[model samples]
Target chain A: MSLLEVRDLNTFFRTKHGIVKAVNGVSYTVEAGKTLGIVGESGSGKTVSAMSILQLLDTNGFIESGSIKFDGRELTTLTRREMYEIRGNDISVIFQEPMTSLNPVFTVERQVSEPFMVHQGLSKREAALRVLDMLRDVRIPNPEVVTKQYPHQLSGGMRQRVMIAMALACRPRILIADEPSTALDVTIQAQILKLMNDLQEEKGTSIMFITHDLGVVCQMADDVAVMYCGQVVEMAPARTIFGKPQFSHPYTEGLLFSIPRLDTPSDVRLEAIPGAVPHPLKLPDGCKFAPRCKYATERCKVEEPELVEVQPGQGVRCFYPDLKERRKDG
Target chain B: MGKYVLKRLVYIVIVFFVISFLMYALYNLIPTDPARAQLEPMRQQLKPEEYIRMYKQLRKEMGLDDHLVIRYARWMGIIKGLKGKFDGLLQGNFGYSQTFKKPVVQQISEPMKNTIFINIFATIAALGITLPLGVYCAVHKGKKFDTTVQTMSILGYSLPIFIISLIFMYFFVVRWGIFPLMGSKTPNATYEPGSWEAFVDKVYHIALPVIVMTFASLGGMTRYVRSSMIEALGTDYIRTARAKGLREKVVIYSHAWRNALLPIITSILAWFLGIFGGSVIIENTFSLNGMGKLYWTGLNTLDFELVLAIQMFYTVVSLIGSLLIDLSYGIVDPRVRVNK
Candidate 1:
């Protein structure tokens, strides 16, 4: 069994206007000792779906219906205390914008060491020593000096490393990193990605990596799940998804084609997926991507397609995910 | 930090002098003679010339006949004192209060004690309630407890303090008779001073006013605390704290509350220093002999010495309050903490 298996998860937020279907029937898995990257645009429920795994949604948000089984235990059925125990011990998370993710009032040692104190029942001094060890593992030089400093005192890259140190302190089995490198500059981003990958390897930690950066997914993800309007429209091995598969979801094709390539002619314009993700409250009734799909049929608008296994290990949620003139009309 | 405090202290002195000088000049210009009020009976008793001579001598003796600048300088102890001694304000001379018929410093004691007495309890009660209540409301924001408290606080906030005072007095003092209608203490209660009984008696007499004071001031602050906490809870750090799997209590109080407390320091300190300012409406409503009531009477009767002393006291307090507030930022949040 996968380390963390989230099945048919539907998370919704209760707003004054109506219920916002932030994550609707999203299902994916993070295998043991491997990285599963969930990629999407902003508001595609990437963060919300990750948040639901820990039941850490905002006050208004709730798991409408979901089965999150972690290590053969049903997380959706666990009591809050049980969930709390599982949170830092079995599953930990690192967020984007490390500058804001860390508590400014506390030193790096305090923030990084808190998981140890809370979960492992270690004394603050004991946690302090562990904090130094954890900080060093994240490759922060001068760990002692960095630990004593506040979050604001550190540079962005250093702060991101501190957040990683904090999340990995408890040696959690699965780490959910939400846009972890998006806020850093390109060089720092690459460094953080490498550090996360290295830490995962050393700790044998399964990772649920969520980001909109396809390049990042290609580098770090063993398998990739492309989400649109809360559902995973395509899931395949990283190489299959990035290296031009024979059969690919149109949305995935749109996402790949939209990347402004350096080898393309300078005068050639960039491609964009036509139309936006529909407002969550007013989503399309059928295949959600149908409105933007060039090959969308009248039937496609009336009937939603199931996420079907198109090949041995790949899944696509479209009537015509094939690109080689598989259409009957042709 | 030391340098900042020292700079503020110097500014305090300069600002205090300028404010006090203006007050003295303004009070003198009011054309109300505190001595003339004292000597009114003598006006009808003596010959006009004799009464005039006595009044002139009395004015000169009171330092009221001096030029405004000279009188201010002498009063502030920039020169040899009014009574041919260096007994100006700088040398611990607050002169005397015609209103209370005692030295200004001596008469100030009872009112100061009474005001601080009520305020300390009221402030403690408010904070004890507000800190937890605000954080709770923020955590459970938009829920029943939060919404209910929010509506009630709005009602409390909108109502003028005097009306609240009247409502409390009517219920507690007039209707229930659970507390005295007025005064800092029983006029002739024979509990020995500093004894437990005396303390209890003081507390009993001031209970209604304290309750009224707390109620009247509770809304603005609880709301302030709630909103500040809400903002704090919205910060990314709070989400990180919750994601740490800490218990709800630890997350709310330790992490979120610590962030919330930074902005709240100023309001709470302002509320604390306002203890000295006292509640004029509440004190007057209950006929309590607190600083607020004394200040009102001092101004109405033109008790120049009393007014000047209280004004100077507030100036120093507010100046010190601002300095303390600025210094506190560094303590609460390291981002604002300056190495120097």
Candidate 2:
């Protein structure tokens, strides 16, 4: 059984204008000890879907309908208290902005030790000891001194490491790292990814790594799920998706081609996907990506396409489903 | 941090000196003769020639006969008191109260105590109501409870203290007659102040003023705290705290409250410093012998010595209070400490 399975997840945000369908009919799963990279642009509902598994959406947002099963148990049916118990003990999440994530008033030790103290019922001193161990595990130098310091005293990378230490201290079964390195420089990003990869390897932890950067996903994901406008358009094994890319979700193609390459001539302009994300409250009736897709046909404008499995473990939600077929026709 | 505090302390000393000099100069501008204001009591007893002679001697004794700069120097105890010893305000001699016929320090001492007592009660009351209510209002922002509290806070904030005082006096004292009309204690009550009866009467008499002061002050404080808490609750750290699986109560009180407290803490310090200045409208409306009333009477009578002394007292207290706030800011926010 998959460690985490989300099916037909629909999340909505109630605002003054109307209800915003932030995550509509999104579905994916992560197997034990494997990483599932949920890649999307900003407001693609990637983070919202991940947050729905933990029921962590803000007060205005909630799961409209979905079955989030973890370890063969239906998470949707669990009481709030039961969900709370699972949150830090079995499932942990690291948010995007490292600079703002850690409480400024608290010492690193206090923040790092909270999960252990809360879920494990460890005393303050016992938690402090484990905090040092976790800090060391995350490879923070001078764990003792670092523990006594506040979040402001640490650099951006160090603070992210502290966040990782806090999240991983309990060896949670699943780690939801939401754009963990988006705010860091390239070198620091590499270090953080390597640390997460190493930790995942050691603990066999299933990770739902959410990011807009396809490169980071390539480095860490075992399976990749491509999302756009609140729906997953393509999902396949990371190797198949990155190498063959048999299924052509034009949005994914845009994302893949837009990445800057050093070998490309400096004068050659990178192709960027056209148009902005449709406002969540006022999305188009048909395919959300048809307006931006160059290969869109007349049928793509009037009818929304459902995700169909074209091969084993591969799904695509489009009429012109594969790039190879389009290449052959051309 | 220590250096920052020491720097603030030096600033406070400089502020105190500047404030004292300015207060002296400003009181001198009131178009009333300092010697005549003091001698108004003996105006009928002395002949015109005798009064002129006495006024010259009194001016000489009070150092008023000297140049403005020389008078200020003497007032700082660089010259002399009546006994020719160093006894100006700088030497802890607050001069005398012409209205009360006593030393300024002696006359203000009791009133000052009453002011402190009323303010302490009011401060506690204001904070006690504002902290929890503000948090609740922020947590339930845009809800009915929040709207109701905000309306009340607005009413309290906008209305002047005397208006609230009169309203309370009418309903609680005149209409119901359960509490006293005015004064800090019952007239001719035999109970000593240390006795429970006197304490109860004091509480009863001061209740209206304290409530009025608290109401007058609560609106701004609660609004400040509520907005601050709303901002703090929206901070990313608060989300982290929630993501940690902490209970809602723990998330708010533990994680959000301390961060929200920075602004409220400064305002509270100002409130504490205000104990010495007291609320002139509230004290005068209630006929209480507090610092506020003393200050009003001193100014109205043009008792330059008393007015200047009271002004110096408020300035010094407020300066020291601000210095403490700046120092405490370093302790509460690590970012400030590091930058320093």
Candidate 3:
């Protein structure tokens, strides 16, 4: 069995006007010791899907329907108390903004060792030693001094490193990094990404790397899932998804073209997506992307596409999955 | 830090001079003549010359005969422990209460004690009840507990303190006969130091007014705490704490509550200082002999000196409370520092 399996998961937020279908029928699986990257726009439900696995959704949000099984145990069915035990022990998460993620009141030592204190019943001394070791592992200079310092006292990169150390302290089987480098500078972003990759390799830990950056995904992801309008429109091996994307989904193509590369000349006019993602509440009939897709037909307007296998190790949701025709149509 | 404290102390001294000068000038501006009031009741007992002589003596003694500017300088000089009557080597005596015919400080000491005891108890009770309730409501949000607390808070806030005190007195003291309706204690009540019955009786007499004061301010505190908690919970750090798989208690109390309490702490300090001077209506309604009643009596009698003394006392207490609050900020939030 896969280490984590999300089957037809749906999450919605209850708002004053209507329910927001934030995560709609999303499904994926990750085996042990592998990385899965979820890529999408801000409201693509990538974060919600990850939060749902741990039942960490806020009071305003609810999982309408979902089955999340981790190592043969149904995660969705676990009580909050049971989930609490599994959270830092079996799975952990690192958020995008390191400055806000670490508690301002606590020292790095306390935050990093909290999981051990709560779950393993470790003594304070033992937890402290483990915190120092984890800090060393994340390449924090002067682990002792860094561990004693509060969150605000550290630089952005240092805080990010501290967060990574805290997340890895429990030796969790899975680490869910939600836009970990989004709040960091470009140079620091590369360093943090590289640090995460090294940590994953050394521990052989499965990682669910969530980001909007395709470049970061190419660097760290073993498999990639392209999400739009709360649904995974495409899933494939990272290289296949990047080199031979078979999907005719305009949104995916727009995302791929949007990334500014080093080779692109300064004067070259970058390809831009014409419009924003439609509000989930007012999602289009049949296909959510039909209004934006250049290849939309009468059939595309009336019927939604299923996530069907398009090639070996690849799946895409579209009435037409031919990129050659799409290129010509564009 | 030392420099900042010294600067604040100097500001406090300047404020003291301004307040004292205003009190003296404003009192003289009033239409009623302190000298005339003193002599009116004694007109039949003395001749016009005798009355004038008494007035002159009184004015000289009160330091009112001097030039207004000179008298203010003398007053400030006395406050700074310069030469004057009534132990000039120390700060000004605060003079005596014309209405009570007693030392102003002596007369105020008992009422000040009463006010501090009642308000301190009420403030603590209000905070203790409101904080957890607010956090619970914020965490549960739309649940039944939240709805119930919101409704009760609205109801509590709507009723004025005097009306609530009256209602409480009628129900608990009149109908049920469970507690005293007025005074800080029963007549002839004496504490035997180790006697449980005496301690209980003293507590019983003070309970109704304290409870009334507590409920009057509880709703506001609850609302403040709830709003602050909601804001803190919305911050990204709270989500991060939850993502760590920390227990719900740990996330709410350690992660969310610490940040959320900043506003609550400030409001609590304000409430503490505001009430420590006394809530006049509640004190009068309950017929408690506290500082609020003393202030009302002083005002009704036009006892300017007593009023000014009480006002000065309140100002000092509030200033100290604010200073304590500033220091506490550094303790609660690492982002701030006393020196900064």
Candidate 4:
């Protein structure tokens, strides 16, 4: 069985104006010792889906319909008290901004060792030892001195590593890294990603990697799920998703074409996605991405497509799956 | 760090000297003659020359006959422990109060004790009520509890201290006949330290005024704390704490409250130093013989020496309070230090 399986998860926020369907019927699974990347634009509900899995949605938000099963146990049915036991011990998450994520008042050692203290009930001395070890594992030089220093005293990259150290300290079965390196510089980003990859290899940890950067996704993800407007538009093996990418969903094609490559000449104009992601409150009927899709049709405008299998291991939600074939047929 | 603290101390000393000098100069410049005021009711028939002679003698006796520069120098000298009849600047005898007909420092001592007693208790009571309620309102924001607290805080803020005092006096003291209406104690009260009867009497006398003072001050601070708590709760670190699977109490108190308290702590210190010492209205309303009342009396009587002395004491107290606040900032928030 998969370590973590999210089935038809729906999360919405109750607001003054109306209820916003932030995460609508999103489903995916992470097998043991593998990486599942959820790629999308800013409001594509990737982060919300990940947060919902841990039941960390904001106060106004509620999971309307979902089944988050971790290790054959239903997470959605668990109480907050029960979920607390599994959160740090079995499932860990690293947020986007490290500088803000780690409490400024606490020393790096205190934050890094908190998971061990919470989950394992490790003694202070043992927690300290493990914190230092994890810090070293994340390739932070001079773990002894860094442990004693405050968050503000360290640079952004160092702080990110400390966040990672804290997250991985309890040896969780699944690590959900939500845009972990997005706040970092290019060099630091590569370093952090490499560190995460190395750790996953060493621990055989399943990872739910959420990011908009397709390059990083290409580098790290074994499976890719493309989300658009609160729903999974496509899912496939990473190589097939990138290489053969069936040019069916115009949204996916736009996302692929928008990625700038070094091989492309500097003078040549790059392809850009035409419109912004639709506002969640005013999401269009039928296919949410229909308004932004180039291959949108009358049928697409009236009917939502199911996430049906197009190939053996690939799923595409589209009314006109063979857009190229349709053009040839025309 | 040592150098930074030393620099701050020197700044404090300079501020102290300047304040003292200003108080001294301003009091001397006032048209009212302290000697004439002292001798007013006693005078049956006195010649101008006699009055002038008596005034000059009194001024000379009080060391006020010296030049402005010289008097300031002497005051600074006393403060620095270089030359003064007293052991040091703050050691008992600064000068005698002509209006009160007693040693200025000695007269202030009792009133100061009363003021400290009332102010400290009231402030502690206000904080005890405000802190938890403020935090709860912030955490449960938009809930019925939060709405209720916000409404109460607004009502408390709107109601003036005098109005609140009158209401309490009416309900608790007059109608209920539960507590004393005014004064720090009943007539013919004698000191009996550690006695339960004495403690109960003192508490009864102090209750109404303390309640009035607490409600008057609680609104602003509670609002401040609530806003700070809200800001702390919205911070990324707080969300991270929740993600860490910590209980709500642990997340709110240990993570959020500590960070939120930096601003609240400083404001509380300021309120303690400023309001407690300057409670002239409350003291008069309650008929409490506190430092505020003493200052008010001294000012009304044009007792320059007594006024100047009280002013100087208040300035020093304020300076010390602020210095302690700055030092505590470093302790509470490790990120802040003497240097930055």
Candidate 5:
């Protein structure tokens, strides 16, 4: 069994206008010690689907239908109390903005060591020592002094390092990183990604890395799931997805084309996927990508495509999955 | 931190000087004379020449004849208190209260003590109830408990203390005769200050006023706490806390509450300092001999000296309260620490 398996997950939120289907029939798996990158634009349900695994949605949001099995244990069926035991123990999360993700009033030691004190049943002194070691593992400078300082006392990159330390302190089996390095600058972003990669290797931890950046996915993911408008339109191994994908959904093709690279000719314009992400409440009836897809057919506008495996370890959710023919039609 | 406090202390001195000077000048503008008001009852008995002589003598003795600046300087002891004897505010002379027929310091000391006692009790009661109530409301937000607490808070906030005090007096005092209606204690009771009887009597008399005081601010304080907590709970840090596997209780109290406490502390300090002023309507309605009632009587009888002293006392209290708040910010949140 995969370390974490989410099958046909559907999550919705209660809003005044109507229920918002935030995550619609999403399925994925993170194998032991492997990274699965869930890449999408904002509001594409990447974060929500991850949150559903932990049952940590806001009060207004509810999992309408889903089965999340973490190491053969059905997470959706677990009591809230049981789920809490798994959080920060079996699985942990690192958020986007490090500056705001830590309580400003608490010391770094308190924030980082609390999981140890709670789950490991360590005394305060023991937790403090563990926190220092965890900080050291994250390559923080002067771990002793950093542990005593508050969140605001540290720089942005340093704070994110602290967050990473806190999340990985328990040596969680699975780590969910929700746009972890998106808020960081280029240099800091590279360092943090490297740190997470090293940590994952050291502990043999599985990671569900969520981001909108294809570049980040290329660097971090073993497998990639491309989400568009609350649904994963394509799934394949990272090499297959990035290197001559056999059955690429039009949305996935557009995402790949949008990447600006140093090797691209100067005169050639970078292709941006056209149109905004459809609002969750007012999503189109058929294939969600059809509205923004250059090669969308009349049939594509009328009938939604179900995700199907066209090749081994690869899935595409479009009627016209061939990239060459679709581009020629446009 | 020490340097910040010392700097704040100097600022407090400057603020007090400006406030006291304005108060004294404003008092002089009132066109009322302590001597003439005192002599009004005996005006018909004295000849015109004798009245004139008494007025001049009283003015000179009271330093009313001196220039306002000179009088202020002497009062603060920058000019006076230089000899072997000291007769200024620096020497603890708050002047005399003509209305109470005693030294200003003596007249105010007991009332100040009573006011502080009543207010501190009320504040403790208010916060003790509201802090937990606010946290509960925030945690169970959108539930029945939160809705009920929010409704009660709105009602408490809107109803004036005077109205509430009157209702309490009518029901608990006039109708039921279960609680004392007025005064800090029974007028002629001889129980020692620390004795049980004296304490009970003081509690009995201050009960209605304290309840009124607590209710008056309870709504605002609870709302402040609730909103602050709610905001904190929505922050990314709070999500991080929950993601740490901390129970809901620990998340709310240990994580969310710490950040929410800063604003709550500010409001608490404001309320604590307000104790010296006393609740005017509540004091008057209950006929308690607290600072509010004394200030009311002093103002009505044109006792500027007593009014001036009370104003100065309030100014000093406010300055000290603000300074404490500034220093406490560093303790509560290291981000604002001046030394760093």
Candidate 6:
């Protein structure tokens, strides 16, 4: 069995306007010790779907219908106490902005060491001793000094490292990192990504990586799930999605082509997918991406498509999954 | 941090002297004569020449015969004591209260105890009610309980304190007859002063005032705590805390409360230091002998020595409270640097 299986999850939030379908029927799984990157633009429910798996939805947001099975145990029915145990111990989450993730009033030692104390039942002193090792595990320099400092005293990159250390302290089976490196400079981002990858390998932890950066996905993701309007449009092996492929979602194609390559002609403009994401409250009737798809048809505009496998282990939510044929016709 | 406190202490000392001198000078400008106010009731019994002699002797003895600058200097013990010993504020001689015909310190002791006693109960009740209720409201924000508390508090907040005080008195005292209507003690009821019986009787007598004081102060404090807790609870760290799988209690109390407390410490400290001078309105309404009412009486009687003593107490309390508030900001929030 896959280590964690999230099946047909529907999460919604009750706001002043109406009930928002933040995560609509999103389904994926994380295999043991492999990285599954969920990629999408902002407000695309990449974070919300991940938040759904852990039942970490905000007070307004909740999993309306879903089944999350971890280690052959159904998660949705667990009591709050049981869920608490599974949270830092079995599945952990690191948020996007490390700058705001660590509590300001608390020292690094107190925050990072808390998981050990909570999950493993270690004493505070014992937890403190383990914190240095956890900090070093994330490759932070001066682990001893860093543990003594407050979150504000450290640099942004250093704080992200501390967050990773805190997340991985209990050696959790799965780590859901929601754009963990997005707030840092490119160099620091690269460093943080490398650290997360290294820690994942050392601990043999499954990772559900969420980010809008496709470049980072190419480097880190074993498999990629492209999400738009709260549903995954295309999910396949990184090789199948990034490399020339026989079948892919048109939305996925648009995302891949938007980046300017080194060999692209200097005179040519970078190809960007036209139009913004439709207001979620007023989503189009057919395929959610139909409004922006260059090759959208009358059928594509009238009938919603289901995620169907056209190639081995590749799923695309489009009537015409054949990207080469669609390109030729255009 | 040490340097910051030392600097504050120096400023406090300078301000204290300036304030005391200004107070003495202002009292000198007042038209009332302390000796005449004191001896007026007894003047009919004395011969006219004898009365004249007695009045002059009393003025000299009271140090009212000196020039304003000399009197102030003597009062502060800035020069020398009148009788080779320092008999001014510095030497713990608070002069006298002509109205009460007693030493100012002795006269003030009962009022001070009463004020502190009432305030102690009020403050404790305020802190106890606001902190937990506010936190719960924030946690269950937008829930039925939160909305109910919010609406009720807003209603309570709009009504004037006197209205609340009178209403409480009417209901608890007049209608129910459950509590005493006024006074800090039961009239003619005998109990050993410091015994358990006396303490219970005193609390029973003061319950209405304490409740009124607490109810009057409760609305603003609760709302303040609620908003502060809500802000703290909404921060990214709180999300991180929840994601840590820590129990919800730990998440709210330990992580969120610690940050929420930074803003709250200022108000709590203010309330604590405020116990020295009780609420004048509440004290008067309840007929309790608190410092605020005492100070008001002193003002009317132009009891300069008594007023000056109270003013000095306030100045000292306020200065110490300021220093603590600044230092505590650093203690609660690591971002605030105390020394620099």
DockQ of each: 0.68, 0.64, 0.67, 0.67, 0.82, 0.66
lDDT pick, better of 1 and 2 = 2
lDDT of candidate 1 over A177-263, digit per residue (tens): 999999999999999999998888899999999999998999999999999999999999999998758778888988988886668
Deviation (Å) of B86 in candidate 5: 2.9
lDDT of each: 0.86, 0.87, 0.83, 0.84, 0.87, 0.87
Predicted candidate 2 versus true structure: per-residue lDDT over A154-232, tens digit per residue: 9999999999998887899999999999999999999999999999989989999999999899999999999999999
Candidate 2 is scored at a TM of: 0.94
Residue B255, candidate 2: how far off, in angstroms? Answer: 1.2
Model 1 error, position B326 (Å) = 4.0
Worst 10 residues of 6 chain A by lDDT: A260-269
Clashing residue pairs found in predicted model 2: none
lDDT at B251, model 6: 91
Q: How does residue B7 of candidate 2 score in lDDT? A: 74
Structure candidate 4, residue pairs in collision: none
lDDT of 2 by residue, B190-287 (tens): 88768999788888889888887887788888898999999999998887787778877888998998899888778878667654444777788889
- Per-residue lDDT tens digits for candidate 5, residues A151-204, read 888999999999999999899999999999999999999999999999988999
* lDDT (Cα, 0-100) at A229 in candidate 6: 97
Candidate 5 lDDT by residue in tens digits, B141-223: 89998898889989988887777788878998899998887877898898897899988888888888888788778888889
Provide a comma-separated list of chain B TM-scores, one per candidate. Answer: 0.89, 0.90, 0.88, 0.88, 0.90, 0.86
Question: Which number leads on DockQ?
Answer: 5
lDDT of model 5 at position B227:
93
Off by over 4 Å in 5: B35-61, B81-85, B187-195, B273-278, B338-340
Best by TM-score: 5
Query: What shift in Å separates residue A244 of candidate 5 from its native position after superposition?
Result: 2.2
Task: Tally clashes: model 4.
Answer: 0
Candidate achieving higher DockQ, 2 or 6: 6
Off by over 4 Å in 3: A244-248, A262-268, B1-28, B31-33, B37-58, B67-92, B185-202
Q: Rank order by DockQ, top first?
A: 5, 1, 4, 3, 6, 2
Interface RMSD of each: 0.9, 1.1, 1.1, 0.9, 0.7, 0.7
